[model samples]
Target: MHEERPEVGVGPWEGELPSEGHYDPELLSNGDRRNVADKYRYWSMEAIVADLDERRHDFHIAIENWQHDMNIGTVVRTANAFLAKEVHIIGRRRWNKRGAMVTDRYQHVRHHPTVEDFVVWAKGEGLAIIGIDIFPDSEKLETYELPRNCVLVFGQEGPGLSEEVHQNAEATLSIEQFGSTRSINAASAAGIAMHAWIRRHVFDQSV
Candidate 1:
């Protein structure tokens, strides 16, 4: 559940209202943004993020950003929704943020110049790294035992996991594929892998 904070008055609105304003004053005056869930309505970005940080999940999310994939934003948004511990970007310095809708501010994101840097960090943190790919000799994600505390790694949209990343993975698992397409979208694949981890380790009532 989300927690709400009391609003702090920064200042009064200064501009005169336009005849045909783009946004509703009632919503804007109350800091209500329709892009977020109801629980976050009328709350400042910092407040929402603080609330999320207080109850974030254990799993981390990492994506290869070599192609400037727009899907990275979607992945970040999903990670925020699921309350991931953190989001890591590997292989590129910049990614398209338009799709994230500024949700990145509410999610902790780290950047690694290469896959090796990410692997090193994961090892130091004692977090297992699981690669999501459809390579030969890879295990089926459905049957694999996902770690309760781990980094879920995903590759670029078309090329999939780089050789170094595939080799560094504690284990590589593939989602079931049946259509003519050789693989699914990277963002969609990430959502699947994250949910699998959640179902296996998190959703269990005894936890």
Candidate 2:
């Protein structure tokens, strides 16, 4: 008979484990196999979220969820990886969470009944709404300097942004695709846009 290999996560704790408040006794005893990073192993879900909250970036991610878009899950996961300030869902509160792989549990998410409501919230937070879609007046993302405090808004998967949302945006930007396809997947586009912001506000600045 073949022996089962060890779990992908850390082994059960030995002597002198971490502090009481930070670690989860169940996880520590069973060996932490959550999707979180190694430093967060054995850490309580609340502790991990609190730690992430302390370092989250100024930028937020909002998705137009009129159709319960599957891409919203991927966007949430990516947002968590990039440590976005929050993830906003517009038009619908329910979305497919399969792609998020439980990362949504650690993310701060809010729902808006409509684009108008989302715009109002953004305005209240003093965040500039930058839509990610290509149009006649849209600027290439490569040339645009993403604001330090802004919400990168993505629209529906196929139709892209609604006319009203497009019109209300302070500015719209698009990725330059070299392929014959007119557009890429919505989640991929969101990831690219977030990376662009990170490139300018985080990576490049640090260098």
Candidate 3:
């Protein structure tokens, strides 16, 4: 006898169908196996995004995709986890989305052809661009008080932050690493930086 595969999401609505506009009819009838929270089980994609927008965080996430970085997707996923206002992709318009695991569907993403274009947009939106990378002048992320309305920008995997982005950033920060590696992975570093921001702004912790 063959073993039955375990189902992912709910099988279907067991009772009367909801009349809310946000509910997805197909998902309700078939199932809702998407990787979303229980609160958004049967919600439409547009409806889920709309509801998230109501309480999105003040900070944004920007990444340089000069090399079509694979880490970009993971960074975007982290931004979604943190409820970032939006994600700005710089350098390359197209990126690898495998690491995002479909979180990008719920996250708002924008593309900028170059660093200059991204800087202009950030300034126009009153978002200070804070770079996350190691540099001569980079400060410790542990001590930094990230601005409430800033964008945490990251660089591509190998080269790290481009000179253009480094020069334009309001400040660059580095995470403390005690291991053998010179630096952590770009995606890992991004998550740490974003969590640092959350700790200060969301939890009111300075360190």
Candidate 4:
């Protein structure tokens, strides 16, 4: 026989129910089972998004999805954790969200049909486009001083950044590798890049 699954989050509001506008009536009456911060356990989804918008980091994250990369979901989840301004998806409209585990519901995700459109949008937003990939002119990501208002773009799992994106990028950065593998995972690269930004701007730590 299969084991019974344990429930997540809190079970209903204990004692006096809170009357805050952010609190969801249903979740308070029933239970808050969504994977969220303790403070936001009973908050409505819109409230959580609104609060996040007020304090989202200046840096943005973009990923290429020409081949329907599965890593985008993980990238979104990481972006949410880091409170990224937004996640830009270049190429396909739909991507595999299993890795995100429903974090997308609280994170703002935008889609671009092509690289050209993405570049146009980034330029309009005054965000520098920094690509993460290994190329002849790629600089070490560790040494790179990521712009405060910029979008760190990553290619799909296999091909890396497309030629168009590479050409349009302000700088293509590469994470230093030690052992056998030539490159790291796309989602992993995104996390590293996002943390680098956080270290630089949020905690005022050198990357």
Candidate 5:
């Protein structure tokens, strides 16, 4: 049987009581509690991360950061939710952090000056790089054999994958499109790719 574990911090809160109260006014009255699982209720970010670190996923996530895209934060947040092994930023060292909602502190993120550097690092780690883009001659994502240990690389919002990224990827995949638009939002696409991986490897056994 699985042993019941304590929620939040390693130990219960211990300190002199404040004149105001136990809970912060801003967090309590404003209803600023997190949307995480019940186990993390009223927990600090540090506690949540410690729990997540004990059971992270195997796959890694990487995005082309040449444009300093605001979408990077959303991607990081989603990656954190899925507990991805790591997040790699290719190109620019800095990106818009507003979308990440302060979750970056809990996730492992790496910066690469260029796509070449990312590819080199991934190869060194025995991680196969898979590019998600709707380009000609690309394999259909639904049918591709995603590796258990791999990095899913996404391009910028508008232009899609860079030439260097395309050339470096072990395989390129395209999501089927039915709408008039050429592609979907970068963050949405990343979520879809991540879910597909989860379904293929993580969920198959249950079904």
Candidate 6:
């Protein structure tokens, strides 16, 4: 079962409001209960998005949606958590958004009709496409030093990355598993891959 949401909401303002452009009058009066951090309470959506845009990492997330994979929403939500520069959907334009929990509103998402189009765009943007999946020749994610600026690509749930994506990607990395299962869920893999990038580019830099 899911845990309960917080009961507390931002209380009404006590004194004169500041001149800063971040505050929202309506939210200040009517408790802000949005699914956001305390720091963003009572702030306009525009303000929150602007703040996020300033610090989003350079890496991007791309997923295949040829089969209308339900995992796409989860991947988009995870990308938002990691603050990826953008999320690219290759194949179908519309996708199931139920798993995203509205986080897609804060994310920058794009669509590509085909793998060829995605590859061409990636090349033009100078961002290397690194496929995430398990294969005989795939490198271990634990040791792989991900590209500083790259697009992390994922595939549909059951099929994994298409042969076209695999061939076009600069390299593919796989997460090691010990159990009898051949692979983890695509959404889980996407989260792990994104966090792996964070560990290398964001977390490692502070130390």
Candidate 5 least-lDDT 10 residues: 17-26
Report each candidate's C-alpha RMSD, comma-separated, in the order given.
8.8, 1.9, 1.9, 1.8, 8.6, 2.5
Each prediction's TM-score against the native? Answer: 0.83, 0.95, 0.95, 0.95, 0.81, 0.93
Least well predicted 10-residue stretch by lDDT in candidate 6: 10-19
TM-score of 6: 0.93
What is candidate 3's lDDT per residue for 1-207, written digit by digit as tens? 999998777878999999999999999999899989899999999999999999999999999998889999899899999999999999889999999999999999999998999999999999989999999999999998899999999989899999999999999999998989999999999899989888998998553
lDDT of 3 at 181: 93
Give the runs in model 1 whose Cα sits over 4 Å from its true position: 1-31
lDDT (CA) per prediction: 0.83, 0.92, 0.93, 0.94, 0.83, 0.92
Candidates 1 and 6 compared by TM-score, better number: 6
- Candidate 2: clashing pairs of residues: none
Q: Let me know the TM-score candidate 2 reaches against the reference structure.
A: 0.95
Better of 4 and 5 by TM-score: 4
TM-score of 1: 0.83
**Model 1 lDDT per residue over 1-207, tens place:** 878985543323346643432334554464453467766654556667777888898899999989887789999988887889999999787999887878898899999998878989999999999999988978999888888989999988888888898999899999999889889998999899989878887787765
Q: What digit string (tens of lDDT, one per residue) describes model 5 on residues 117-180?
A: 8988999999989999987879999988788899999998988889898998889999998889
- The alpha-carbon lDDT assigned to residue 173 of candidate 4 equals 97
Runs in model 2 deviating more than 4 A are 1-6
To one decimal, what is the Cα RMSD in angstroms of model 4 from the true structure? 1.8
Better candidate number, 1 or 4, judged by TM-score: 4
**lDDT of model 3 at position 137:** 100
Clashing pairs in 4: none
Query: Residue 95 of model 2: what lDDT?
Result: 95
> Compared with the true structure, what per-residue lDDT tens digits does model 4 show for residues 6-102?
9889998999988889999999999999999998999999999999999999999999999899999999999999999999999999999999999
Stretches > 4 Å off in candidate 3 = 1-5, 205-207
